[model samples]
Target: MRKNTVGTAVTLCAAALLTAGLGTASAAPATSPAAAHGAQAQRQPRQPVLVDCAFQPQARPDAFILACGDGNSRLASLHWQHWDGRTAVARGVNLVNDCKPYCAAGKFHSYPVVVRLAHPEPWKKRPQVRQFTQLSLTFTGARPAGYDRVVTLPLWS
Candidate 1:
């Protein structure tokens, strides 16, 4: 009986070692639907926001003015980037250390802030503006400090 018990234990131990050596260590197979969907999402290309301009001549470079929410005077600064032909991106930040009267006081009305390109106009080799076209806006980041909010604007010229 003692010999039989010893032999069984040795066999089990040997089997475990063999499995490990064969690279057959157990790993949970990804079988959940959420896991599969998440993987697929990662593989898919991201989409951009589409906007239509109603203002005359649409909103063009050095002409598109942005009206950001005002009141707290927390607005720190504004930056703009020109893309392709009909798209513009603007980012704003509230660079206030403390929400005091010195930095941010009012927090009610919307402030009309205009943003223009640092580059010269007349897109030399670019296509001529004819009419309003579809636009896309993608917001990247936002926080209480620095430029955390990004706005994509649509303009025609």
Candidate 2:
């Protein structure tokens, strides 16, 4: 009976401290369901991006230039199908210059292709940003003459 009385008194005192918000905070209180969900959403990983030649991170970009020096090669009318941390897939038109006689007089040619961006790594300029480092184009039907069916290129960071 004495032991029961002491335990009961301790329990009552602890309960009173908690009720008055004076209890030790070593143990965190249970979180609400909404708060837990919000925390999960916040913890979700951010999607990777494509960095342009000017060193800018872009998400779901409609167009990306392959040749930054002369701007002779580029992709346009991009329709992105997938974008994630590992890879990104898109269907677009690869506009390349013929450079038949000279680049100064070169004419742009459009070829249908399926584009894939992979090999994501942190950007050198901005370590916090991850960007696609490789680009691949698979010609759907007709491809540029002297060009293979599939071509892979290193993207500029």
Best by lDDT: 2
lDDT string for model 2 (1-157, tens) is: 9999999999999999887675446556788899998886554336777888787778888998888999998999999999999999999999999998999898999999999999998878766667889999999988888989999998877
Candidate 2 TM-score over all chains jointly: 0.70
C-alpha lDDT of candidate 2 relative to the true structure? 0.87
How many times do residue backbones clash in model 2? 0
Error of 1 at 100 (Å): 46
Q: Estimate each model's TM-score.
A: 0.22, 0.70
Per-residue CA lDDT of model 1 for 32-58, tens digit only, reads: 999887876554312221122233333
How many clashing pairs does model 1 include? Answer: 9
What local lDDT does model 2 show for residue 155? 82
Query: Candidate 2: which stretches are off by over 4 Å?
Result: 1-45
Error of 1 at 119 (Å): 21
